[model samples]
Target chain A: MSDGARERILAKVRAALADVPRGEEPEDVVVTRGYVRAHTGGELIGLLVDRLTDYRAVVHRVPAAEVAEAVAQALKRRGVRRIVVPPDLPTRWTAASSVVAVADEALAVAELDGVDGVVTGCALAVAETGTIVLDAGVAQGRRAISLVPDYHLCVVRADQVVGDVPDAVALLDPGRPLTWISGPSATSDIELDRVEGVHGPRTLEVVIAE
Target chain B: MSGTFVGMPAFPEAASAATQNAQLRHNLRKATHTIRGKRAAVVSELDDWAELRAAGKAIKDRTLRHLDVYLEQLEEAVTAAGGHVHWAADAAEANAIVTRLVRATGETEVVKVKSMATQEIELNEALAEAGITAYETDLAELIVQLGEDRPSHILVPAIHRNRAEIREIFNRTMAEWGVPAPANLSDEPRALAEAARVHLRDKFLNAKVAVSGANFAVAETGTLVVLESEGNGRMCLTLPETLISVVGIEKLVPTWQDLEVFMQLLPRSSTGERMNPYTSTWTGSTPGDGPGDFHLVLLDNGRTDVLADEVGRQSLRCIRCSACLNICPVYERAGGHAYGSVYPGPIGAILTPQLRGTSSELDASLPYASSLCGACYEVCPVAIDIPEVLVHLRGKVVEGKGTTVERVAMGAAGWVLGDEKRLGLAQRAAGKARGLVPKRHLPGPGAAWTDTRDIPDIPEESFRDWWAGRGRGQQR
Candidate 1:
């Protein structure tokens, strides 16, 4: 089935594009990409905060050494008692949160779902778009940890924040599974009105450690 | 696959009847207007919007022009990454392939991310016939599935249903599906979403097989990207042991770098967000990560026919953002159901006809659904000239109908317009006899045009006569 269908479709496609002049390469059509790579250019951190807040995520900026304190405060403020901590996330970051730190060692789907939240260090953050990209890296863990939990707290280092989508795409390796979170899960499916807090994380708290 | 929309009435018939439903019209107007404002705001945020639009269009055009080459590259890359690639020439074949894959996994039930491709093929119906059930996980999709209704919008399939309607649907239908709605569910948007989340969570957690549709497939790395607002996409893409993604062959991009353009373009154009809540991108299978067994099904299902049309093929550049739908006046009045396909609105008017051909009355009437307002093109992220394609498809439809009165009328108009002298003579004659022309209706075959409304008041005086009176060749 694969062999026959594949050739037939390809032949049809080649036949369909018969209008192209002979020897014309794909690039001959010359795609002019004059779009700017970055849109806003204020203090990147401040812009990131503005964007994250627009999406209704709680954002707190703290000094580099006080990330754990911020994490603890965010959890305490939200009254989350237990959080999924992926491997390689600096223990010091969540050790003092006073919340139960459940290890994400291949946690079951239902188990992860039952946890209070999952907090991980993001691979990168985009300032222009306010997106946190998780590549299932050592610190980020797999895609499930960030998704299944009802609440997600992400730690963003100032160094990990990029300017825009293209900047993040340039730095990312597509082979690894990637999850880009712009806000808490939201939907505008009803009457085209946006309502935050859907299936993903109802509450997304971000700790920006400068 | 084609059974769902087997005998839909022509667009005019359906649209007129649809407009009579004040509730449907209200739902559509509110929803479309809301999205239209948001889209304009986000799209205007960048000074380089036109450039981005051009680049997005160009990328898709190039990929489509050499689709065979890129598809081969994608297959090789996916194969190298431990994923199996399957080619489906049509809907039946794709459904068969997916059913077989699910059967091999021995899973009676599968969770599905909302996919136009799947809906286009009616995959759920096909799977049901084969004794396998596919559960739609997207919130809007869930509402439609439960209501036993067709999707009315691309981004918000249940946009035609208000919160009150959704509450009723859930309360009445949720128990039979899997989990029941909370004993008491309110009509608030938040409550409805929560109900859906709770109801679908069980299915997401325990599903052994998942079916999905890709937003973009990178031929460069074999990475398939799914952009979604809810975690359902992430759940289906990550939790399942066996994952199958059915993608249209036209959904290809030549390289990973191309994703940067589309990623920026799609989110803003769709949902008016800087980025969607969750965008999951993966290349085949990772040892201990996501799905252990990955299968990519490339489907044609009339896409090749669409590609063969030079003028009509621009519809293929659509990323399914539904920006055109949100900005269309025709869509706002008649709603998505009138278009008679998984695709609706201006893009649907052009794309559906080419894909399905103009053999059916519904297909033929689709090309004429729009007023040729060009609003869809202005909002289109990929800059598909939907109006251009609509007129082109209209010509195809007219040509297909051998010696129809409308075709004869258009032919007469064309003949008159071809020679300036004849056109001027006809215009002068019409202007001299303007009082004889009825404002209400024309006699005989022309009555069809005025069945619903009166004809224009003969344009006071011909523009040609006005131009001549103003000294045609001289600068006024």
Candidate 2:
């Protein structure tokens, strides 16, 4: 019965576009995808670090072998006592971190909020925008874990960093719930003055592993 | 979409008071200038911004041209993803569908993620009529709601309000809504934000159903994407058990790759960020994450009517970035409240008239609101020629009503200009009577035009006559 509304609306849309040549595929519009896809070259990781820090997200560039130590240092610097981690997160990343790693498996929203912060791995990072994409894959737990806590410490491997938005988007799975976080949640609503730490993490510490 | 703006005076009548409000003018100027500066800096960073803009325009045009096919494909994909898709032909139907969905959850309250679609429908008012209370979680929206004020800007709804006003609103109104402001609440932006955070936290954690609007919806994956600064949107999108997204049919793009273009354009154009703090994308219902039961409401209202227009159709390509609003001189002076709609400024000048038609005084007066400066055209991410549409709608308004006086004047001028002899005779006669013409106001309908402007002094000899006589003098 509700299909009547659907049909009526579609019919209106079709009638509205009756003048547009029919049977043309959307591709026939001949869109000029002529924009430069990437703004940086091999320096994308450094660009990403620079951009992230510009938004006040504490960024750590560490050697690949010291990923665990970096995570531990970030957590300790923020004085995070308890941290939430996804069940599928690689053990070595947080192996040296003394903060109690609360597995997000079957944890309620309230319990997740009780933690001081969340430690997660990212799907990819965008250099131009200083964004970290989390698609609830292995290490990036459910959206709530990253959001509920006051602090978020995320790890981004050098290989996972892309030069621009187009590249980062290509790596993401739209089917999975995705969160592209640029910095700690901030608002410029009042007098257009930026005030950080609204609803998301007040602090975002990105540890960039080379 | 709602009748809140009904019975409102026409644009000139409405703007008269706004133009007089010195404080409003100052506030608007400051806020717009700040955002405009930020936007210009970041936009210049991209070397291929022109190409990016063209692609944005082309992509939207393609999607809108074949919108029916995409909508069908979208429905199928969403259904396949374990989500239910509902359709609404207008605001009332959209409101009813959303109300029903919320009622089904048996929840009296629903948290909202600053949706202009919902605002267009006056969904909160409709929900209130259905005995449901909707809480606006965005900081600007919260201020607007608490102050019982209307939104003035698109991206920052309460851009008109400064820190002092926001602090006052929170202090005065927060107690009425579950949470009270701190006794020593200061006017600092951070302090105000913290108060809002504490006030809205309980609502976010406890809400069973969440209602939202999407920035973009991917047809291929049945994904709804929302970009927001505050985690309020994240909470509304993720914490709730039942999630209902009310989106305009025009908000869809064909594929995930299409998102790549907008993801870059929108952030840079709006709020001047490379990316907002959080951008959440979900395809229907996720098994264990985000909202478990999802519903998508595709709203048309008057969009199909807008889509039908060839010249005016570009308005639909607007991503609600408000770059046009920031750069518009008219909007800077007269302010958004003067537009008297959910949408204001350059986009509003064209979009509102088409969506609502010229039936009402406010709607009819909208087309004339712009100065046709073309600044809006320059900064538009989708490159919507807002001036072109404004002129088109003005023609529609003149055609639809009692424009016999204007028509007669135009007809007389056309006749004189049509023949060289007739124009020469008329010009000579005007030259003879040039000394008799008044410098200030003219009589009858011409008075309105001359009231605030000067009547140009007629030349002693007509330019055409001078040109013709010059050739004879040169021959000698």
Candidate 3:
């Protein structure tokens, strides 16, 4: 059955293109890819911080040595009791926080949903669009861990921030499951009015570690 | 709507009522203008928008040109990634394949993302007949489903409904659908979204089967990309155990590099955002992350027929962004229901006739729905020359099977105007009968035209007669 439908569709397509010249190929089409890759000149980290804040995501900027303190303060402000983290995340980042850190491995979805928030590192962040790329890499757990909870607190190092979408795409591996998140979940469906916090995390806190 | 689009009235007949609806007109005007302003602001931020638009058009064109080759490549990649691929020639086959797939999993209920491809096939209605329920998870689609209404716009299906109307729908219908609304829910967008979140949480957690449509399918990598603002799509894509995606054959891009161009073009042209909140990409059945069983159904309902026509083939490049709908003057006044298809607005005018053929009154009248304005062309990300295709389809309608009263009248006019003496005699006859003509209304075949327009009074003397008497004296 599959072969029959497949052959018929391909045959119809072949018959439709009978008028084209034999020598013409898909590569013959000249598509100029001259669009700018990165718009920010040199203030990518600053732009990333600014754009994320514009999305109503809480932004924390601090030196590398103060990363733990920043996470602790963000968790304290939200009054989160328990947080989920990927196993590979640096132990020191959550060492200062008072909340219990639960590893994502073998945790049921219902258990993850019970947690107040999830904190982990990102694959990279785009400055112009204010998006974090998660490939289920070392510190980033499966897509569900970051999605199910009510709050998400992500950490982005200064070196992992890119200036634009193309640069971010170049750095990530597509073979792995990838999720690009710009801000907390939002919906503009109601008469085209944007309302944040639908199904995913309602509150997003980003810490830019220099 | 007569429940569905079948046997619907012509465009002018349907639009007459919609134009008189001041509330709908006001709602559409406000919503479209807001989005239009936002789209323009974000689009101008990119310095090379024109180049990006050009690349988007070129990539789609090249992909369509070599579709057979790329489709085979896509099928191989998807199968190699442990996802099953199915081929469907038309809507019926596609629906049957999906229904059977759902039954194979022994599940009666499935959660759905807002997919136009499934809506085109009326899959939910089909599943209803088979004793299965399909829950619409998108906030807009949920409004449409609960209200029992047709989707008027592509992006926001409930564009015609205001906050008050949505609040009433939720209060009246939410309890019947599994979760009830909060007591005395306020008419605010945030409160309504939260109500939906509470109502759909259990369904998402318990759903074993999920179905969707994709924005772009990377042929080389077998990855399907779905970009959405709300996280409902992520829930439907990730939480379920079995994922079935029904996509049109034209959604393929040759490579991930080709996908980069569309990733930039789509979000800005669509929600007028720098980037949407959520973008999910999965190659196939990921062992532990997303759904373990993935099925990709490629649909080809009348697409090959569209591709055969050289002039009509460009309509296939549409990315369903609804930018044309937001920018259209006719759409703002007449609204989207008049088009009578899953696709609507200016793209609908050209695309519906090509996909469904100009057989029904609604389909035949779509090409003439537009004012031949080029605003849709200017904003189209894929650069579909919509006005050009509309004119081309108009010609096809006139030359095809059925004959209309207007065609006969045009034929008579052509015959008389072919010769100078016949034209002069006809003009003189009309001149003599000028007083008998009605100024406001015509009696017979011209009533449809004159119902909404005025008829010009005929002059006492023909222009030929006035010129003929003066020319001989000047020659002497």
Most accurate candidate by lDDT: 2
Candidate 3 local lDDT, residue A65: 98
Per-residue alpha-carbon lDDT of candidate 3 for residues A1-210, written as tens digits (9 for 90 to 100): 345888888999889877767888888877888888877697888898888887888898999999999999999999999999998899999999989999988687789888999998999999999999999998998988898998999999999998888887777766788899999999999889888999988888999999
Give per-residue CA lDDT, model 1, range B272-311, as digits (tens): 8888888999999998888999999999999999999899
CAPRI-wise, candidate 1 is: high
Give the lowest summed-lDDT range of ten residues in model 1 chain B.
B1-10
Q: What is the C-alpha RMSD, rounded to one decimal, of candidate 1?
A: 3.1
Quote the positional error of residue A28 for candidate 3 in Å: 1.2
For model 2, state the Cα shift of residue A81 in Å: 1.4
Per-candidate total of colliding backbone pairs: 0, 0, 0
Range of the 10 consecutive residues with the lowest summed lDDT in candidate 3 chain B: B1-10
| Worst window of 10 by summed lDDT in candidate 2 chain B | B1-10
Better of 1 and 3 by DockQ: 1
Model 2 alpha-carbon drift over 4 Å, by segment? A1-3, B1-3, B400-404, B472-476
Candidate 3: segments with Cα more than 4 A from true spot: A1-3, B1-3, B400-444, B456-476
Per-candidate fnat, comma-separated: 0.86, 0.86, 0.67
**Model 1 Cα shift for residue B273 (angstroms):** 0.9
Deviation from native of the Cα of residue B44 in model 1, angstroms: 1.2
